[model samples]
Target: MSLKVEFDEPKCVAAGQCVMVAPDLFDQRDEDGVAIVLDDSPSPDQYDEAREAAAVCPAAAIRLVEG
Candidate 1:
């Protein structure tokens, strides 16, 4: 199983939910605080945390695609 993480910068509200949930998978930009994708393809161990990040995101900026 393979998973992909995608972040929408324009929709980011700097809520920091993604970072709080999955620090290794997502990060905030120093300049704008918009969430950035750290690892597009995460390992199986990170799938749950990645899902939590997306679920906790207030701006709904994080997206998960599994293939």
Candidate 2:
């Protein structure tokens, strides 16, 4: 199985939790502090961190799908 990351920009609140949990997989735009996904499909080694990032997202803008 593999993981997929999705971000709904309109729902983002610039909380930065995702970035804090997984800096290598997520980032924010300098223009407006909106989240900018760095990796949509992270390696297996990063799955835990990526999952945590999605969990910690206050805005609930991050979605993780495994298939």
Candidate 2 lDDT for residue 12: 95
Task: Find the 10 residues in a row with the least total lDDT in model 2.
Answer: 25-34
Please give the range of 10 consecutive residues that has the lowest summed lDDT in model 1: 32-41
Clashes of each: 0, 0
Candidate 1 to truth, TM: 0.94
Clashing pairs in 1: none
Best by lDDT: 2
RMSD of each: 0.8, 0.6
Which TM-score value belongs to model 2? 0.96
lDDT of 2: 0.93
Off by over 4 Å in 1: none
